[model samples]
Target chain A: MEPSDLAGMALIAVAGPEDALAFVSSGASSSAALEQEMNAVLNDSGVPRWPGLAAALLRWRPRLTDLAPERDLRVVERLGGQLLVPEDPEWPVALSELELNEPIALWVRGRALVIPEQKRCIALVGSRDSTSYGANVAMEMAATLVQRGFTIVSGGAYGIDAQAHRGAIGAATGRQFLPTLAIMAGGVDRFYPTGNEDLLRAVAENGAIVAEVPPGANPTRYRFLQRNRLIAALCEVTVVVEARWRSGALSTAHHADGLSRTVAAVPGSVYSANSAGCHRLLREGSAVCVTDAADVAELAGAPGTQLTPEQLGAPAVHDGLGVEDLMLLDALPLRSVTSVDKLTIVAGIGATAVLAGLGRLELLGLAERANSGWKRRC
Target chain B: MEPSDLAGMALIAVAGPEDALAFVSSGASSSAALEQEMNAVLNDSGVPRWPGLAAALLRWRPRLTDLAPERDLRVVERLGGQLLVPEDPEWPVALSELELNEPIALWVRGRALVIPEQKRCIALVGSRDSTSYGANVAMEMAATLVQRGFTIVSGGAYGIDAQAHRGAIGAATGRQFLPTLAIMAGGVDRFYPTGNEDLLRAVAENGAIVAEVPPGANPTRYRFLQRNRLIAALCEVTVVVEARWRSGALSTAHHADGLSRTVAAVPGSVYSANSAGCHRLLREGSAVCVTDAADVAELAGAPGTQLTPEQLGAPAVHDGLGVEDLMLLDALPLRSVTSVDKLTIVAGIGATAVLAGLGRLELLGLAERANSGWKRRC
Candidate 1:
C-alpha cells in the first residue's frame, strides 16, 4: 500500500474527520508522525492540548495499529468503486469548506466525471414521507434543473429524493453528462433501503453513489443525521420541497445556512402537516419561498440559463410568429384538433379575429385543418 | 343647515377623499370659503395646483352650488344610521393616519362602541370567492382574536370577510361589547350583494357597518378599491387569508405596507390558484406567513390574552389536573359518550393509565359516567 493510503486508513480507523484535521493542522505528514507528536503533547505539562485531542489519540492508538489498509483497499476495489483521499483530483473541493468536519475519505461508486463543481450542483431534499404535491414538485423541479445543465444532489431516500433522481434520469436521454447523485448514509457498496437497489444502481451507472463510510457499513440513525451535512456541503443551493416539523430535511437546511449557502423551501397548504417545517422556516426568515424551477434558478444566480437549442437538438421555433399568431398557436391543441370557437374562447379573441389568426397560422405551417377542427403541426 | 355640514357635503359631492383633504388643508373650513380659495388658486399662476384639484373643482363647481346638506342628513337619518364628521368623538383616529387620503366622513350604523382604537383592531381581508379552507381559517382566526379582546375589522363582502364577521359574532354572546366592524364600499343602509343583507343587519346589531360614502351611494369598482385603504388604515395589522392574483386584498396589504403597518398572509397550497397572491406576498417579503390566530395575535403584539374566565361566564376548569388527566379529559366526548379504549388511543396512554385519569377527572367534575362510557360535563 502507498504511504498516503496507510495514513488515510489509519486516520479513519483511529478517529473521525476532526482527528484527521487536527493531525493535518499539526503539520504531521503520516499516522506515525501524528502519533509521536500527540504523545509528546500529552506528556508535556507546558503544552496546551487541542480540544479532545488527548482522549481521541488514546482511544484510537490501538485501532490504528490494528487497521489493515490493504484489506480495505481490496474491499473497495471488489465493490467496483474507488476511495478518494484529499489529494485525489476527483475529490470535491466543496467538502473542504467543512474544515475540521470534512469527511476523512469518500467511498465513491460511478465514473469520476460525475463529481460536479460546487457551482453546478444543487441539493433537493425533503420529507421521507412526502405528499403527492411534494413529489410532483420535486420531480418537475429536478427535471427542469437537470435540463438546464445542473446536477441534482440529494439523500437517497424514498418520496422526494427518489422522484428527484427519477426526474433527472428521465431528462438524461442521449446525454453524456452526469445529471444526478445519491449521497448515502451507509456504504455505497450495499445500498441502504434495499427496495431502492434498482434505482441506486441506475444512478451509479449515470452519475454516482457516494458515502463517507467504507464498504459493508450498515446505516444508523446518527449516520443519517451526519449524512445530511455532506449533502448541504456538496451543493451551492439547498431547496427543501416539503418537511414536517422537526424533520431531517430541516437539519440539512440548517447545515446549508451554517455554510452560508442559499436555502429555499417550497410552500404547501397550511392545513398540511407536511408543510409545517417549510412554513416555520419561511416565517422565521431562515429560508426563501420557492414555487418553481425558475424561482430556484434565479435565486441560485443562473436566471434563464436552460439547455441551449443545440443541447436540446432542436432549432428555436415560434420567434417569427406575431403576438396574435403566438397566442393562437398556444391556444391550438397540440394533439386533438381544436375548433375555431374553442380557440377564440381560449385565446380571448373575437371569432372573426380567431379565423383571421388561424389563416395566418396555417400559412406559416404552424396550424393545419383536421377532419373537424384546426390542430397544431409538429 | 350647519355651515360645517354644508362644507362636508360639498366636498363629498365635488371629489373624492383626496380633494376633500386638499380643501381642508388649505385652511378653509366652509364650502363658500373653500370655493373662493380654489377660485383664487385657479386664477393665480404663482400657487402650485394640487395634482387634480383644478379639474375636480371646475367639474364640481356647478354641483357644489346645487348641493343640499339637509337632504343628505335626512337620507342618513332615514337609514337608521349616523353621519360622522372628523369632529365626532366616535371617528376612528386611525383613519386620520391616512393623511391626505382619509375619508371626508364615515356613514356608520350601530352603536359607537364598535369602532376600536388602532392598536386594538386587525384587518382580515381576502378573496371574495374564498375556498372552504380559506373561509374556515378566517372564521377560526376571527373568533380567536375577538375572544382575546381584539375587535375584528374586515370588509362586508362574501367569502372570507363574511365568515370573519360571522366568527366574531359567534364569539360575542353574553357580552354587550361590540367585537367586530364591517367596513363597506357603499352605504351601510343598503348592503350591497343583497344576499348578505341579513348578515349585515346582524353585524349592525352586535357591532357596526361602516362606509366611506353617503347612505344612497352605490358600490362602484373604484369605491371598493378606495374603501380598502380605510380597512388597512383602521387596523394595526392586516392579514390576507387567501387571495387570487390582482385581488383587492392585495391592494389592502399594499396600503398597510405603505403605512408601515404589519402585513401578514396565510399560506395555502400552491396548487390552489386562490392562494397565488398570498404566496406572491410571502415571496416578495411584503407579508409574513401566519397560520393561526396565535400567530396573528403575537404579530399584533398581544399573545395568550384570551377571554378571562369571568368574561367567558365560567370559572376555568381542568387547570389543576395532571398532564395525563388533562389529556384524557380532552379526549373525552363532549356531547356523546366515549369508551375507555377510545380515550386510551386518543391520549396515547395505557388503558390502566386512562382509567386512573378518568377517575381523577370525574372527581374534579370535568367528566361523568354515561350509558356506555365517559362524557365531558358542560
Candidate 2:
C-alpha cells in the first residue's frame, strides 16, 4: 500500500471514522501534514482552528503516537484476507451514499465481487426469535430470489438471517456468481454468535464475509446497529419477514426507507405478536405488502417482471349475467316451473323485460323452459 | 297509508325499485297519473317517451290491474312489523348517498331506531366460512366497539355476521340504544338461513331485522349481493374481518370505498385462504390495516376518540447513551475491569474520549470504577 493509504488507515482509530473523513477532506496530504496541523492548533500560535478541533486534538494526540498501520495490514494478510481502501478497484460505489459516515476500509474474507450491483441484491432480515412461519417464509423468499439471478444480503445472525443464507446456498447450483453475502458487526476473521460458525464458514466458501472493523474486534451492541446501515446500503430492496412490536429489523427497514429503497413486510395473523411490527409498517405506509417471491421480484423490478396475476377460484355459474337477468334467474324455481305472470310479481320487474331477460339467460345456459313454464337450470 | 304512499308501494312491483323511484320523482302525482302516462306512451306515443318507456309500460300494465297495497300492509302488520317508505320519518338519511339505487321501502321487524346515525354505526362483515381466528377477532372488535357506544351492522349470514351480533348483544348491558342491526336479503318476517334462526331471533329482540322486500320473499342470490350495499351505506366505516379471494365481503368493501367511507381490513397469515381477500384489499390500497378496536374507533372518529398509544416493551439499559458512550460501554468487559488505555484501542477512539465517556457512563449507573480501572455494571 502507498504511504497515503497507510496514513488514512492509521487515522481511522485516532480521529474516529467521521472526523477522520473531515480531516482528510480538509486538503491534508499525509499523517505528517496532519501532525503539523495538530501541533499548530495546540500551541495557539499559527493557522485558524475549526470548531471542535481542540476537543478532537485532545482525543487524537494520545492515539496518534500508537497507530501501527503496518501491523494492522500484516494481521489481515495472515488471515488470508485483504484490506480494501476506497481507492481499491473492488470498492463498492454504493457506499458513497453514506458520505462522511462510510467506512475507511473493508476487511474481506472471500471473493471481492460477491457484493453485486444494488439492483441485483436484496436483504431479507427479521427477528432473531422468529416463529417457524417467518423462518419458512424467509427461506422460501431467499431461494426463489436466488433462482431468479439475484444475490441475498443479511447480517449473518440467527433466525431469519441464517435461514436466508441457507436457502440461498442450497439453491446455488451450477451458477458461477455467488448467491449470498454476510455483513458482520465485528471481524470477518471469526464470525460472532458462535452457534452460527459452521453456517458462516459455508457462507465464506460460497460467497463472502465482510466487516468494517479490524480483525480481533468484538461485535458490540453499537456495532450491531451500525452494521445494519451497511446491509441497507448494499442492496436495492430490504424485506422484513416478521418482527415483534419493537425489533432491530425495524431499524433496518427505517434505514432502507430513509435511503428511498423499496421496503416490504409480510403479513401474518393479527393474533401473532411476532407479526405486530410488520403490521405496524404496513399501517404506517412505510412498507408495501409482500407475500411471496413473485411479490418481491416485482418490487425489485427484475427485467421483464410483473406481478403474477392472482389465482381466482372457479367462476360462479351465473358469473357474467347482468342485473335484470340475475334477478330473473334468482326468481326461477329449481324443481318446478311457474307462469311469467307470477314471475313478474316475484322478481318485481316488467313482464316484457322478464321475457327478454329470460331469453338472454337461456342462451347463457343459466335458465331453461320446463314442460309448462320456466325453471332455473341447476 | 296515504293514497300517494300506497300508489308508490304498488309501483314498486311494476317497475324495478330504482325505476319506481324514478317514476315517482318525475312528478307523476299518483298511480292513476302513472297509468295515464303509460297508456299515452303505449298507443303510438301521445306524450314524450322516455328511453325504455314502452318496455316499462308493458310490464306495468299487467301488474297494475291486480295491485293490492292494503293486503301487503296487512301481511306485514300481522307479523308484528311495519313497512317503512322513504317518506317515513324513521328512514335513514344515510341511504341518500345511494341516490337512485335506494330501496323504495324497507320491511322492519324491530325498533325503528335500530339503524342509528351514520356516525354511530360501523359494519363488520366477512366470509360465511371464516376461521376461528377471524371469528374471535370479529367478536372482540364488535364487543369493544359496542362498549365504546357504537352500533354494529352486518348481513344476517352465518359465520362472521353471527359472531359480530353475538358479541354486540353480549356486551349490550342496560344500554338504551340497540347494539346491532341485521340487514337481510329476504323478508324481515322470517330469517333466511335456517341454521341461524335462533341467533337471528335474538338479534331481532336486541336490535332489528330489516329488509327491502315485503313478507314471504325468498333470500335470492341477486338480493344477497344487493344487500351488501345497504350494510355499506348504513355505516361510516366498513371493516372486513376475514374473507376468501372471491368472497362477497369484498363487494361491500368496494361499495364503501365508492361512497368515500373509511374501509379497514384485519391482517392474517398469508397461508390462510380466509384472509386472502382482506390482504388483497390492503395490497390494493383500498383498506387500511386494523388490528384492534382502538384502530377502528379512531377510524370511525368518535367524539373525543384518539388512538391509544402503542404499548412498548421494557426500555433497554443502553437506550439513552450517545454513540461514543455506547462504543465505550460495548468495549468495557462484563466480568473484569479494563484500563482506559486498552479501551481506547478496543473502541477505536482517543484516550481523552474514553476517559471522559467513562465518567458520564459511571454517573448513569452503567459503569463502575474498580481497582484503578473500569468495567460494565450488571
At residue B196, what lDDT does model 1 achieve? 87
DockQ of all predictions against the true structure, Cα-based = 0.11, 0.39
Q: Which stretches of candidate 2 lie over 4 Å from their true place?
A: A1-51, A59-84, A303-310, B1-51, B59-67, B78-80, B303-310, B349-356
Q: Candidate 1's error at A166, in angstroms?
A: 2.4
Q: Which 10-residue window of candidate 2 chain A scores lowest in summed lDDT?
A: A1-10
B211-241 in candidate 2: lDDT tens per residue?
8876767788777887888899999999999
TM-scores for chain B, in order?
0.68, 0.82
Q: What C-alpha lDDT do the candidate models reach, one value each?
A: 0.75, 0.79
Candidate 2, pairs of clashing residues: none
For candidate 2, what is the DockQ-based docking class?
A: acceptable
